[model samples]
Target: MAKLAESNNLVGRVGNAGDTAVGATAGIRLRKSLPWCAAAILGLVGVVYRAILIAVDVPPANSDEGTAGLAALHIGEGRDWPTFFYGQDYMGTFYSYLAAPLVQVFGTHWWTLRLPALVMYAVFLLLVFRLTRTLYSSWFAVFVTAVLAFGSDRVVKDQIIGAGGYSDVATAVAGLMLASALLVLRPEKPRTMLVVWGGLAGYIVWTHWLALPYVAAAVLLVAWVGRAGMTLRRVSLAVCGFLLGAAPLIVFNLRPGRPDSFSVLLSLSGATEPAAWSDRLHGAVLVGLPLSSGLCAPSHCATWQLWWGPTYLVLLVAATAVAVAAFRRADGGGRRVHAGRLALVAGAAMTLAAYVASSSSAMTPVESARYLHYGLVSLPAVLWPLWVGAASVVGKVGSGTSGDHGGIRRRVTGPSLGGAFLAAGCIALAGAFVVGLSVATGQLIAHRSDYAAQADDEQRLVDGLRTAGVSHVYSGYWTCNRLAYRSREQVRCAVLDEDLSPGLDRYRPYRDQVRGSARVAYVLPSSGTMSVNFARSTPALGVDVVSRYELGGYDVYLCRQRPERG
Candidate 1:
């Protein structure tokens, strides 16, 4: 009886041990999957938020967006094919091509125009998560993803607005970073990564040259890490990939009569006649930083206080410092972190320098922050140091020993003190992000209604033009392409310069069609240059305003123009 009882107890013990083992395995699986689950949730939340904003028309449609939409419309109808944004030798038509099929299916609505940007943002978030996880810890990846999921209003607009190539630039930069990371981490076989990195680099060059600095940094990092893996054949494949990806740009530039995109890019960069470095640096540090950091009010950020600029500078400096320190003593994963972080810092620095030297910075520094938007791609690297420091401190504290000297001492060790400081820094970052979200929420609520109303007024103007039987007209830069897009070519408008003459005229065919018309109307805003130019310049150009009417904030004047002397 005693032997049987002992055997029963042993069986029960074995069963209990087996159950514990199963539970431990399950826990390990859960831990491994949790970060991925959180990342997906964050990405979904971001996409939904952007979708809601688009539905509400948060940023409102503009001429740039309208031009992109019009390109899509033309491509959809097989009317005309463009390699680049109409009237520009840069900013490839990839976005329009993406939207082409959608325009055909959905019939050129605002949502159809914006859906590509939404998709790009979703992909960008996923890339960001994957890249961060590869370079740092899962915990850091989740944190970075969360930071970007609900960014400030400026960041939101940069990500979601379908204005040609801005969102595409972000996605391309993330892709480049990821490919670079993979090449470094898996250098034994780097052919695929080399091709991917090259393709992304070529695509970004064609998509938006503003991201060139990032491409340069990515290329350098890949070369650094994959030095051993690179061979003549593999490198040739990468070259072929770049040639293939950049075929459109190469073909366009090669065609006779096409303006050199490189020249156009350089002219735009203020490189021809450089600004004073002092002023450029000041603008970059004060206005550009604040604008990109989402700390300044829109449209009038120049006049705001400079408090927001330092916050970004501090964060960047701290992260760069940590990266430099890590590189000096790196081994294994630390080397990868150092390389990734250094590349990001180099890219961001180059972007800032490019902006500072650009004519846009010299002219309208605050307003031209759109150029600096590419810096958003480097955010994961920027936060890596803080993440590592926190983890290191916590680990040291958790593994430390307590000692007694004389009486039992109640004191924190060096690791504990460091942990306290890291915790405080983390709290500050959280607080900053919370404040940014609050401001963004308030701005969205306040401005969404205003933009919707503006869109309505625009529609009213379009309706008035159609009712008046005005198919071809001339308007300011901001109103022309928008009118064309919203009217779906039922009404065509060409851009007029500040002097109310033929200007930019993105699609030359539109201008030609309008100029060929003997009868044209002047659609001028109630205020600003439209008002001043009409009252001052139109009469001088043999433009006779016969009849006039008002449509919301616009004034439409039906006019007849006499032929000009050659």
Candidate 2:
């Protein structure tokens, strides 16, 4: 019996040793993979944070946003064809075409409208990371992308006025610009790159006229860089690709009696309000610094307009100096520093200059933040390379000073200025993440209650319209579509502005019918009604308000258009 017991104890001890060995191996592996695990967790958090915002913001906020969602609903029901931006042939029907399927599958809601934007946002992140990793170090890519994701959550928040309809389109165009810049930096086949890039530029013009400046800047950059290699065949192919991409816009606007597309572009182009230098300075500062005051109030951003110029100016100067110093040191330290590596610098610089020139003409009489909303990452994208060059200078120093040629060390763990640089970087990154992110996230939370109340107001207006037996509504171009979509098309609403007829095969004819003899009511938002201005010009026309609904964001009115009196 004693011998048998001893044999069992020996086997048990061997099993225990095997288990301990396995656990120790796992611990080592986990430690090694911690950085990757951290990146994944951060990415997941960003995605979920965006998702939560989309889920909570129930009603659409921007007039354009409502238009896009409503347009998609019409497309799904086969009531409309994929058409360009309502009233403008400058943009393509790409968003509508892409969003229509999702609308059909999920049903129309604020979240459904933003789902495509969310996916595009993810694509933007991946493409930016790939571009950065290709141009610089992996650690640098991770750091910059993390900071951008943290600070720019509002782009995904769906609550901004102008309704963020252009959010995904803007993000997608920016990603295309980055990818195009990457190709220019390392194009194996310059001809193919030209063709691809040209097609993209063409597509961007049709998607959003606002992005055209960046597209033009990129095309110009690539052409200038590849001037030596621009063969006749390559130029022809590139031109063809660009023309082909723009064919839809061209054909649509060429229909008999349609306004000349270029005329329309010119008409829509130019700044309505030329801001003074102080305003210009404020805007430029905004390019570098995201103040808390700049958020929440999408239209005014009154708080953000305060004196942040000095602060950002100082930061820019310091960053530029540090970056130059680091680059010079690294060049001396035997690292290959080619001036050609400065592709992003040229692209982004020109893009900013072009944007300023173009948007200067489009601003309202008062300084508005609408134009700056799309390029939240432009400054960072431009300046991050300097920061990278700065860090590389540190890395070069750390490598030389480390006595630990004995063992592998993490990238930023050296004892000297190497560690100091890392500390500074982490501090700056954390500060940016905290200030921009906290303000944005806090604004989103604060704004949610107001939007929720807007939802109630919209519902009451919907009920009032139904109660009045109002079969059709002629509302401001922006307001008409949302009221129509939310009412599930039971109320066929048409834009009161003749110029803003939606891009649809049936829209013009449908408008003619609705305006002729239908029992049409008028809906006006409290802010201003585009139709009201038009009505004042025609003294013969009369409008009488039968019922009015007042709410937090809008004052709704139900009125009958009385016949003209002699």
Candidate 3:
């Protein structure tokens, strides 16, 4: 019995030994691959979190989303792609055009529409990291990337893929990528970076109009400050690449059967008289910059402005102070590095200024978020250096010091103190993020019932419109789009553009076709155009409401042709 037991024990020991060897080998391999594994995991977590929000769907669908979705569907199904912004013909087509292929594959659903944002954000995160690592340190790069990936600004959340918000935010991020590229790859360096610069420029000019300013400002600033790096090879290559990127947009606009591209560009140049100097100043300082960063302000109220504007102001001030301090502290060669750092902040400010300076066609009394959504992209440029510099400076100064509690030494070392400062900064950011996310989630939860009823109501309204056999739909600028998009192209829909004085015949072809047609639906809000639709719609106009839908927010009116009085 003893001999048999010994034999079994020996076999067990051999098996245990084999398992240990395998685990040790894996441990060594994993250690070698730790960095890659960490990145993959972080990326996966961020993407999956965004995916979940997109999958669940919240904050309800807005008009901009509907416009993009329906237009994408129109393109996917091989109908006439919208030449410009839906209802407004002057806006760029790049956003809707890019999503058409994906909509073709995935159908006209939110997930497919938002998929591009997810992919783009991932790329955005990567580019930010690369840019930071090149300019700063890997540690700082990782820090900035984390804040962006996990930060919960309402603007970013609302603009995420499938949020169906305008394509401005996504394209603006692309613009920032181009700007960052320009900074990292100075044109005069005579490197391969100019090819990248030109290519990116082409994409920017051809994409969102809101984003063009960022890249433009970056190029001009960099070219001026980086005089040493400017070479003929770089200039030629950059310009050629820009032309290549811009070629498609130019060709598309110039095609035999296309909208007059020059007119669109000309119209965008702003008012003939230009905005009042006072209005321009107001917008640049109060409305444009603050609003662009997701700060809301009322015409008569300064309270909100005081709170939000200064918060960024403080950060910007810190960024400037740090840049100057760094420059003063650096030697001759190091001065260029600090100067570039300062230049980024200056470039961001200049971009903001130029955007504000552009004539605003903002029709509303209150500033709209769309006017400055691109600010979200420029934010990281200012934010990254602020955080990194604060941490580094604090770490350097505060390390090797301790509180004097009855002459008791805390035994703090420079490394430990520096780490604590970093931890503290990260924690503060994390806390703010948590609060923002929690508040957003709470809002979504509290309004869950309201949004639920809204969906049911919208679906019901869609069915009602179809049953009425309504062929044409035009609603208040905000209302027309979602219904039309949800109808799956069964009904033509639009919002009247700003320049409707040109007459119906000069507008989108369908508007002219629908005018005087037997069936038309008007989705009017309680205020504007409601009294006119009922009181002033003349008999000769042959317009009257057939059925009216009273929803929680607005009224949907289906019109009928009055019988002719012969």
Candidate 4:
């Protein structure tokens, strides 16, 4: 009996010692992780601050940015919620609505409009960290966050002077993060998680109609994963939650005067015909590649040719491999699935869908970096798992014996090989980072002159128009939108092939009413249109060019039209 007690005590002591060692090791790891987390947080803050500085006081460069800024200005002015310059419905009013308070407080300042987007982007980075940490380890989470912090081109564009506050990128990031969280949380408590999943879905739809299908796929994935053992109550809860969250948006969408909203949703869902393959390919290369490259670059149009470098491709391949491995090992059983993996899958799907949907007959093989902004959130998610896998492999190989080897012998033998592999992987990743960064820097430097020239010309044109007693005007291409936003003038029309139709249509009635109304002061012709059309259209209406400026391969024509005095 005494011997038996002694033996049991010995066992207990050994177990306690093991537990103590483990706890100590975990404590050390946690301590080491703290600095990295702090660094990431600080980095995120710096990025946001930088973005605010760059965007503040800068005029909107793109039509989308100009339109969104205008909408926010309208909201600030206490105009109707959805109505902008021409009573046209703005598809993405969520960001505009969020920007309202800021607009109200700041009164149409660039920083005021841009601040909300900056904050949302910061939230997105933090969420990426949290979600990555929850699904993986701190190391992996930090790596993922770092990639996101630097890997997105849109961040630079939106942050930079004149890039305009592209809120859609922020919206897509937030929506993807929310969807990832819901998927990760769903497996633990089906009933509670269903509400989250449904709510996120609705929010995505409201945020950007483009993100809805991705959100839907995420929800369906959760349902499919949990279908077999899920309780009826849990299923019902999910459905109810989804309906509850989606009800408001649905009602708003169905409201009598929301044809634009309805059409946007349909277009995103492939109800509309796919864009031409050439056009899609062109967008993919021109916008997608450059933007992707910019994520690693220091500025815009940097090293335009190498925006999508080999490093991104390598990391993507590695990530895909790790994801496939992890997914294959994941059982339907109780072990909590990693949310990062699920997010990666969902993100890839969303990106693919966006690419396919955005393609048109005019799409070229080279796509635009801008259009692929939807996939920005997904890229890091996909990269995280591969990094984790590489680290794990290193740790394993360094431990010496393949399995069950004597501890001392294994320690001495394992670490060398493991360390080498780990070092190599890190070095490789670093090289890729350098390449991307270099390319981005080059692109930015190359485009600096062009951008500066354009800015100067744009300011001159706006000044001239405002000086000429032109309170409202119609122009086509980039300058029109820029002037409207910067000069706060009502743009009667824009001539562009892109989807500025909504903004342009606002001026149609004015154009038609020209015969009956006062004479117009200014008319701008688009470079995209033939000069013959301008000559025929302008003289017939008694319009003559008063001033012209050329910059960045674009010409701006300022015209004055004879007004009809009553």
Candidate 5:
């Protein structure tokens, strides 16, 4: 009996030894993977820091940003979801939902309202790392994260806006990453993956309806690429998952007073053909290239600006060449896919399609630019592979292996290709970092005076109106949205013919009612067309000019008046 017990103990010891060895191996693998992990952490930190700087310096002052911020503020104020702001039924309940907790904890500070966007952006970076790692190599994952961290002009601008926060960028990026991760990781058991992907897709649609087409295209692409021998059961699961995830948002959208833009597009029956070739080509160059060029310049220009000189052109061409090469060289068929190439193609195709569809009749350059931004997130993928390839060449040269072409080839063959890819990735990432820093510094230096003046003028207007005992104000173009957001007074404004006019129209009927009731205590005119019209048109009501201030090329006028009751 004693001998039998000893034998059992020996067997137990052997099993324990095997388990420890497996665990030790896993630990070693994890340690070796720390570099990629560190990159992700650093990328997140960079996003957070950038968000903080933008929040501190810019404030939530722009009309779009302020509009969203105000809605968020209302939610923070314990208002229920889907509350009306102005006359429009503001259904941006998700952003408000996110802001509610922050407001509860931090009050209605601009930064607090902006925190959701900041958090979403950081989350986006983390998702990028995870998705890229799953689809590609660890090195490529780090490379992708770094590029997104530093390369995107829209991302930087959205971060700076401090209001729209990161709604559009965050939703699109996160949705794509999540969808891609599920597709790559669980290609076989697509039921679970489809549910996750569909939920994210629905959330993205809710966040930015404009991006629905892009999202749909991406979903279709994933379904096609990662088909994994789909059965009827799998197809049914996918369909059900998509419907389940999307139904809630779709129902909400279909309700009375909900936004209907997405529905309108769908009902149009996809009959809208592509735009003219000339228009698409022009957009590809002007919208894609020049807009990106402005990121390298001091001022962020949305159109063809003279600021982008020969150097900008050269860099643009070089980047384009690199992107083309990467796309062409990318292995379309293999066990390991080139996700970067797929993303680039998908993004470019979507952008081109959008341009063709919209620009067929009217040459609205700005609209084209805006629509193209949906696909612009894929730019990093296109550029990343080229940068990685270049870095590999540089590494080979540096290591004196360039002379031994056969040795270099052997080193880059098979699994070692991932390592060579990393060599290139590091260099490209460093370059992107330097460019981002340069652009950021340049913007700060060039715009310092303008931003400071705008800030001072904004504060002055707020203080001046309060001092003058003004309440129930009607703002002209200059103080239209600004005063409405900043002042405690109930503000009104005419629908100005401008970029944000569509949004402003949401309040038009209310403004008309206030005008009819003669409830306005003050009128503030901006030194622009709408303000000038207000000043000239409302003269019979006796304008008592309280103060005038200038900000960013617009003159502001604060006036006290009793509206002539009819």
Candidate 6:
């Protein structure tokens, strides 16, 4: 009986040990997956957020977005393989290419056209989460992700819009940051990684000129971190990678009759109008930063969300100060963390300096804020100090020195002041995010009513044109592409300038088609330059207006013949 009891006890002990090992392994796996799960959830949230914005037309579809959508439509039909935006040589057609398949499959509604931006934003969120986690902790990653999942009104607009390369540039910048971070931490990184970094840099060069600052910062980061291991072979490999990624830009420029995109970019980068350095600096610091940070609305900075603006500025300044202090005393792996943080700071500084010097800074803060969009990629690093300090303070408070009340008191007193400051900064940052989200949500709601009215007007216009059998017409720049795309080519319109002259038509075929029509119509806004020009020009051009219909804000004149300016 004693031997049997011993056997049963040993078996029970073995079973308990096995159960403990299984639980530990499961716990380890869960820990490993938690960050990714958070990332995936946050990414999904970001997509849904942007998708809702796109559906409601928070930005209201403009000519630029229409052009992008048209490009996708053309790509779907194999009408053209464009390397750059139709009228803008500096902005790549990558967004259109990405949207082509979606447009082809789903047709060209705003959602289908803007779906690529959603995917790009998801990628941006994932990369940002990974980058933050790598530099700091998983908790920091979640914080950053949550903040970005619902960005400020301006950030939401930039991310959700399909017009320009804003979303694409943001994603590329995040990728550059992650690649730079990896290289900084692992000096012995394989050559392939260098190639990838170079490729991303090259891609950014073509994606948008606004991203140049990020590309430069990323290159400098890797150069400094891998300076010891960098060799001619590695450099050559990077250059080759750059060439591979930039092949489209290079080939397009090298082709005859193509405008030099580089020159275009240069001209764009130069001053739009001369302004004093002080004014530019004032605009960048006072207006641009707040708009970029989402502390205030664009152009309405001083008036809207006034309280959060100053609070955020103070938090930003405090965080930066703490980061500098931490960097000075950091050691070991902490040194690497600070190095990464410094690189981000340097990038942001360079961006600010560039903005201050550029005439773009003199524009409305909202207009100029687009130039600062990529700087948001550095935000995680900028806010890292606050998070780290708060975490350290919590740890110190929780740590017990049993029977040493004096020691505990001393520990608390020593870090308490700084810890409180850090904690306050963090709390303010969280508040800023909440304020930003509220502003975005509020703006979206406000835009919904306007969007519905605009959409209804557009539909009425389309219906009138179809009912009148108007297959070809002349319209202003803002209406031409939008009308054509929305009508699904049922009523094609050639673009006319404000003066009723030949305007910048993106697709020449549309113009030719309109001009060749035996009878055409004129679609002009009731109060714009195009209306005045048409009313004055048609009489002298000997074009007879047989009939006129007022459709929404537009005047649709059925003309006996196509009007031409002599």
lDDT leader: 1
For residues 302-361, what per-residue lDDT tens digits would candidate 3 score against the true structure? 344423344555666666787688668655434444454555566456555555556662
| Root-mean-square deviation of every model | 5.3, 7.6, 8.8, 7.4, 7.9, 5.0
Per-candidate Cα lDDT values, in order, are 0.76, 0.54, 0.56, 0.52, 0.52, 0.75
Q: Model 2, range 333-403, lDDT digits (tens) per residue? A: 11212122243444434444444454452343123333444454344444453454345534543322122
Best-to-worst lDDT order = 1, 6, 3, 2, 4, 5
User: Against the hidden true structure, what lDDT does model 2 obtain?
Assistant: 0.54
lDDT by residue for model 4 (1-566), tens: 99999999999999999999999999988876784677478557547544734453332356555556666666778865652223333243656767777767765445566666666666666665665554444555566565555533344555432222234444454554555454544455445656665665655555455555466556655656555645787767766766765565566666786665656445544426657665554445444545554533333343544434444445566665655665565444212243345555566556654655554313432323444455556655545534543545445422211111122122222336666676577656655654665455445545556655655666676666566555555555444545566665443444332322223433344344332334343333335543435555555646677765543344445665555433
Tens digits of per-residue lDDT, candidate 6, 1-566, equal: 99999999999999999999999999988987886788778778778877877887666676778888888888889988988888767788888988888888987677777877888888898888878777666667887887777656677767877875898888988998888888877667787988898888888887787778778777876787667778899889888888877888988888899889978877877566678777786677777776776656434565555454344345556655755676676554455555676677767777777888788787555677777778778777666645655555454332211111222211343457777776666666665656766675565566577767887787789888988899998888888888887777888888888877788888777888887777898999997777777778887756789988799689888988754432
The collision pairs in model 3 are 65-164, 114-161, 114-162, 188-229, 188-230
Candidate 2 C-alpha error for residue 292, in Å = 12
The residue-level lDDT of candidate 1 at 257 comes to: 94
The top-ranked prediction according to TM-score is 1
Candidate 6: where are CA atoms >4 Å away? 1-22, 188-190, 270-272, 276-283, 295-328, 389-415, 527-529, 540-542, 562-566
Give the TM-score (vs. native) of candidate 4: 0.72
TM-score of each: 0.91, 0.71, 0.71, 0.72, 0.71, 0.87
Clash totals for all candidate models: 0, 7, 5, 46, 2, 0
Evaluate model 2: give its TM-score. 0.71
For model 2, give the RMSD to the true fold: 7.6
